[model samples]
Target: MAERKLLAGHAIRRLRRQLGLSQVAMAEALDMSPSYLNLIERNQRPVSAAVLLRLAEAYDFDPRKLNAAAPGGGADAVRRRLSDPLFADLAIDRHQLEEWLAGAPDGAEAFARAYDRMGGGAAPGAAPDAEAAVRREIERWRNHFPDLDAVAEALADELRMGAGDLYGAMAERLRVKHQLSVRILPAEVMPGLTRRLDLHARQLQLSEMLDPSSRSFALAEQLAQEARGEIDALVRGAALDRLGERMYRRHLTGYFAAALTMPYARFLRACEASGYDVALLERRFGASWEQIAHRLTTLHRVGARGLPFFLLRVDRAGQVSKRLAGASAAPLAEGAGTCPLWNVYEAFARPDELLTQLVALEDGSRWFTMTRCVRRHGMRVGGVAARFAVTLGLTTGAAGPLAAAAGVALEGAAVPIGLGCRACTRPDCPQRSAAPTGRTRVMPERETGASPFGFAAD
Candidate 1:
């Protein structure tokens, strides 16, 4: 009973104190007897709308704020919080829990439990079944294709084309073999056509306003579909997690197309010459920042030169769209991709802005990242369009050799950024939506602080 009533009791007491309202004062404001207000504030009685309305009317408080003071987790809040997957082990009545906590104390305690359990092993005595399965399958695939690396190596060697040029080949293939014509219609004519591979007519058309880099990327994607069979063969008889398989297959196909245009050896040489400057590489290969970043991470495949690279992309929601590696073999899981201080989130507020950040991973690995927002297919004869941000990253240690010979210092450099509000642990981040459980907030509490969570560095 005490466990069940603790959060509500805590909330009512806190609210009363924060508002500087005494039991007598609150009773008068809500038209209730002082004893009744005391009982409710003590969790001896459930908060009722009558009391809720009275408190609001008298105190100028939002009713919802009062509700966050509820007990046992609100039904909606619980459901939304459990949607994070970290709470899989708990036998929670999500709806009931959410409702119970609804409009009350915001379940700050529950959030703390969720965070504590996230990185821990699964329920007692269970052998991390999902992770084992994922690794087992990936290993099985690796063993089956002793020659898999050779195949990627060979293909990487053969396809020495640039992104634009490789995509152009695909466009040519569509036109010449399928009798499909490639056209650059204005955003109005084919507002919806971001690169529709019209199988019926064998045509691939895109908006004329499409940026050159995007045009190339779309073309490469189309080429991936055309070469799907060859890609599927690379992973034949191997086990892969659902997301892993999807990413691997798609990665291979796109890589094949990139290899075709950029060719391995030549591209590596150029990367070295350009000091791996993203913009310079964009101009050199006629690829978008995304494609260049993708290729940079792929440089770790076997015989290719230089340090390993990890590529990550985040949108406004802090959702990672792409995560791949050039050298480091970090496990790929959706939940693990977020870090609260990864500067990628900042790029969204300042669109078309390029920002740099240095991020330190949990294990002490540090990375250098460049972030910017890039959108495609916004205007049209008529349509709702697509907008997103693409953040590129590489290791500071690995970047030294690959970067051009220019005199800029590249060591121990990074820009700080966060993955998203829910996943990041960095306290005192003004942009945080909710205070992550356990971590202390560094920023001073402010009435109108720029950061949503009212955080500052300690």
Candidate 2:
């Protein structure tokens, strides 16, 4: 197959405009003729490899930005929006859609945003919910923030701390730099609260019910709030118009907490050396299973990177609370709990024990998954504790190295799984809760198969 030429004219124009550079100036920087640059910017000519290298060397531009799949890169998202059931009757062609995405990128993005706001309704100009919009933005970015990683790494170096001394260093910094005392309070005084900061008294309060690791994380979260300026700048640079200011700040703070707990370079090195061992890393860093799994999803730095793992947190009731995918992992669809056959659900049966599985999806793709159940500390001794199953998985093709290092065999028969019952097309799934949509159910007379619901043969 011939290699496709990169044609990201709109991206080029946007970058130039952002840098306050005219076409002539950009062309000069790239050592290209102004007319040729104009043609490239108009999508009439492809951005050649030489010019791509020149842009990188001269302007310090990210080469990925000139690729069609860069963040906010193309109209694929808009096309997916238009293909929804609401626009089924409207005749639209791929070429015309591409033209719109290329020539009028902003308008196409606006249309996509409006469609999202409609929330699958045919209604016009429906207001988008702020929380939902922020959630979508977080999903879009795959819950990874490189800027937060950089800031956290700098902070960790400045404090002269590693994974072991992170909590002590942060607490000392809080006391010396910010004059805030860390206090462990009883659950009665602070009901249903894990951590609370008293700005007036300059004290950070933590619940006594929390374990040592949880208390340390709470302190790191408080320190993250102090670095809100850096996080705010990152959110602003993201240019997510739908994300409300408050939601943006909250998510960024969460990012900071995760980053501070697992500084990028040190964590990445440890992950590689340990073959992505969750328990070992948790013990080493004084972090929890959920925290280690969540940190695995954020190893997206340019040069250094860990396995492209996807993390999923599901409650005992099977509701997915968080899902984050690394750069190379396949995305988990939103609004549906994964198939019950996956080890993620089974993890609840064996709490705190690492369960490994090879899952084969409906699309014929396979993945290696490891899951463990995590318990959240309650405010009181007899209080109900919240339990969640956390799963980390990678594509089977890329799982060889980590699986070998972690002493997991990849040659086992894989468990058949699906996105969800509603979306899955697997026939005769014993654990299937509901029949897949668009499939006709068949009922035999006095002769039922082992499976609950039978579907008509194709």
Candidate 3:
């Protein structure tokens, strides 16, 4: 087989810009002529493997990712997206889109993101809340931090953990390194708080309200501050308000905590070994449904990865508590794109039990989704139930190894779905609560149409 020439000009240019280097500076640094570098950046000339090696060695990058997997994958995705019926009227020629990507890769990404944020067909409204802003920041980066993962993996190895000893291991680290002991107190003492840091006493207090997993996560979150410099540097770069900034910082602490406890390399091995058996994982890592599920979304380390799962949690009222995705930009990643038809909502019917389903989105993407009802803060504290359903999913084709996909042929079993009510253009959907924007509902006076509320076809 002939080896394909690497015509990843945009990727090379993106790498250069990320390092804050001008084309001339970058060419000189790579020991290459400016003309050759210019030709590569413009997609006129192919980048040689030798040049790729130099760039990797000089900038400390993974050579394997220099071309971003399939170099044309992003362009192909954009082309598919533009082919949607909504954009059918526009000229979506492949050459133009490829030119746009080659000309300004960053700008093309920004435009795609803006389009994703449009929420079906709704007009732009108010600014996002702190939660939304934080979620977007996490999702924008695909909820993985390679730097934190690498750092935590080394630290986790030093701990030399045993099964069911995560809390003890992390707490001991705090006691020895930061002089903070772990104490569990009565729920009445902490009132509404789960974990509190008593700097004066040098003890971390936890409410009896926490389950084994919650207790461990609380400890891990405290230990995450050990990487304060790294976490803060990332947070400082984010465009957030004071409140939003603080919320983002808190979320980062949670992310770091998950990385430290689960530790990317070990966790990915466990996931692959078990075919993502959540029950076994729960016991192995001492994680709750939510903790382990959230960890699945962060398994984005190069050369080592689990299934690119998306995790979403929604309460009974249909309010989304959290959404995270690994390698995929799933439609469900949109906070407002929650389809009522999704099995995540159905999980509420059978609390604590897993519900597996195959669903097809409007874009013809098929996914294998797993949903389970989970409680916030672990095991119904004081009989005060705060229930939520967490859903994990990935492309059905990629999920071939998963047990659920064994006999899951999409032709006969896939359930059709759309983004959401307003963003969703499916007027025939019986579950739709709101009419789609710019479309009129055409209900018959004597009888219903195809659905209870019919609408004009596009």
What TM value does model 3 have? Answer: 0.83
- Against the unseen true structure, what C-alpha lDDT does each candidate score? 0.53, 0.72, 0.74
lDDT of 3 by residue, 1-458 (tens): 02556677877877888789899999998998999999998888877878878987888866645434222236644553454445644656768887887787777766555554453223578443566556555654567777778777877887764434666778888889989999999877887788899999999999887888888888888888778887887687566678878998998888888888888888888988888888888899888878888888888765576778888888888777677755666766653557878777877779857898988877678888989998676333356778888889988878887765567674457888876776567657878877664467777778865565566765
* Local error of candidate 1 at residue 84 (angstroms): 12
Provide TM-scores for the models: 0.53, 0.80, 0.83
Query: What's the true lDDT of residue 104 in model 3?
Result: 76
Give the least accurate 10-residue stretch of model 2, judged by summed lDDT: 68-77
* Candidates sorted on TM-score, descending: 3, 2, 1
Best of the two (2, 3) by TM-score: 3
Clash number for each model: 50, 0, 1
The better-scoring model by TM-score among 1 and 2 is: 2
Off by over 4 Å in 3: 1-25, 43-53, 56-98, 109-125, 128-132, 161-164, 378-383, 443-447
Best by lDDT: 3
What candidate 2 gets wrong by more than 4 Å, as runs, is: 1-8, 16-30, 34-132, 139-142, 161-164, 238-243, 333-335, 403-412, 438-458
Instruction: Write one digit per residue (lDDT tens) for candidate 1, span 186-266.
Output: 666765555566667656777787777677666656555555565675545233446656656655656655654555566
